[model samples]
Target: MKALVYEGARSVSVKNVPDARIERPTDVLVSVTTTNICGSDLHMYEGRAGMESGRILGHENMGEVVAIGEGVDKVRVGDMVCLPFNISCGFCRNCEAGKTAYCLTTNSDPLTAGAAYGFAGMGSHSGGQAELLNVPYGDHNCLVLPEEAQERQSDYVMLSDIFPTGWHATELAGLQPGESIVIYGAGPVGLMAALSAQLKSAAQVMVVDRHPDRLALAEEIGAIPIDDTLGSPIDQVNQLTNGAGADRGCECVGYQAHDPQGDEHPNLTLNNLVHSVRFTGGIGVVGIFLPQDPHSPDRLYREGEGEVAFDFGLHWFKGQTMGTGQCNVKAYNRLLCGLIEQGRAAPSWIVSHELPLEQAPQGYRHFDDREPGWTKVLLHPEESG
Candidate 1:
């Protein structure tokens, strides 16, 4: 099988790898049709995340089930399915409670509670950025797609990650219908957050980012684009909201957030959200924050126990609430898929490139470099054959 393998920092290669097959009775073998190169994948690609070489690198995946294990009763061969980024046993305490992201039974390490394909510190599961993917807990992990799935792979594939994650950001922020919200970062997740806000009927949706191309995408979705490069994002949001600040805010940039001049400030977005959101409002953080960054030049980030100084005082003084964690994708993908089937949501609008699996190396380069027009990338593994 052909797969995109992580070679080293900012390096990847398309190589023929061992074939993926059913490893357990509850597993399913998928002929991967579509997969995505996520922004989070850049953590490993950039060497910030310790990813061992030779690990396949993809988590956003969807495909046709080529085979199903005997224990898999619900899923069948030939079914088109989107696998959530999180791999969990549905019977786990967390999975039973709809918090599948933190399933206790998936990761073998006691320190970590979640498992994800091709992610560092998650689990041993191989990624789906290949011709074949062996999915554990098949019936529980595979999200069967609608009849239109074959035609709308671009949109349905998003069910694997970003769309639900974007929705999760809003849910965490406690966004109410007609309430105004501001999302930091206009990357793929941020754009999806904007889309989610629109679907939830936000009275005002504002997105903060320095990238003109990304901010333009936000504008396309009727979100007020606040360019941070021009001035203070807090001031922009405050002015836009008549100095009351937004009713809700989302941090989608995570810890790698930097200024327009490319200076890394781990807590920049968090503090920005604290100031941009209205007093007593809620904030949701969906961005990835590492427990440690050994390569960080900042002493606090290297030794503060995953802490970067943010405005916690203002957060407490303002009585603001925050929800932080990876998204429980299974909780939202179904309804979001229904919206897609009904022609209500089109996440494919953010897809900027579709390439053969072998081209993933180039895709990673462009996306990591934040090249213009490379908003999102979908890779077709089958096309590589």
Candidate 2:
């Protein structure tokens, strides 16, 4: 099988790898159809995240089940499914509590926070970027798609990660119908967060980013666009909200946030969110933050320790509440899928490019550079029966 194997910093390629097959009684082997190149993948691609070489590098995946273990019963051969990036043992205490992302039975690393597919510090499960994937806890993890899944792969595939992730951000922020919200970052997840805010009937939805294309997409989705390149987002939010600030705010840029001048400052976005929201408002942070970054030689967070210089003072003084972590994708995907099936939410609008698996490196380059108009990139592994 050919898989996108991570080479080194900013390097990856389609390499022939051993075939993926059922490895456990609870496993199901899937023939991958559509996978995405996510910003999270870029963290590994640029070596910002410590991923081993030869590791298959995609997590946002959708495919058809080809073989299932005797223990797997929810799905069978020929069933199209979307695999959530988080891999959990359903019987764990955390899983029992709806906290699948922090499943206690997986990746028992006390220092790190969650378990996920194709990520360092997560379990050894290979990702679904290749022609085949072995899905563990198949009945619990694989989301069986509807009959129209093939025609709607682009939209359904999002249920695996970003779509649910964005919605989780809003839920974390305690978004209420008719409330005003501002989301920082116009990347795919941020854009989806804005979309979710709209779905919740937000009276005003504002999205902040420097990219003109993404800002335009936000506007197209009924969100007010705040160009960080043009002016101060904090001030703009104040003016837009009649000086009261947004009722809630979301931080979607994570630790990769920067100042208007493009200087990397891990806490910039969080601080911006704090200032953009009203007193007593809530803030949700869905951007990826790491305890250790292998690519940063400057020791931004101390070796093996992920710490950001957050404005705890302002957050406390303003009496704001906050929620942060990887999304518990299983918590929202089923219903989101139903919404998509009903023609209500079209998450696929964020997709800016589609390419074959062989063109993954090019897609990586464009997305990593965040080239103009490049918001999201989806990859298709050659179909296999």
Model 2 alpha-carbon miss at residue 272, Å = 0.8
Candidate 1, 20-55: lDDT as tens digits: 999899999999999999999999999988898999
lDDT of 2 by residue, 27-65 (tens): 999999999988788878888878898888889999999
How accurate locally, in lDDT, is each candidate?
Answer: 0.94, 0.89
Q: Which pairs of residues collide in candidate 1?
A: none
Off by over 4 Å in 2: 108-113, 294-300, 383-385
Which candidate should be chosen as best, given TM-score against the real structure? 1
Clashes of each: 0, 1
How big is the positional error of residue 293 in model 1, measured in Å on the Cα after superposition? 1.2
Model 1 residue 110 CA deviation (Å) reads 2.4
* Candidate 1: residue 44 Cα off by (Å): 0.7
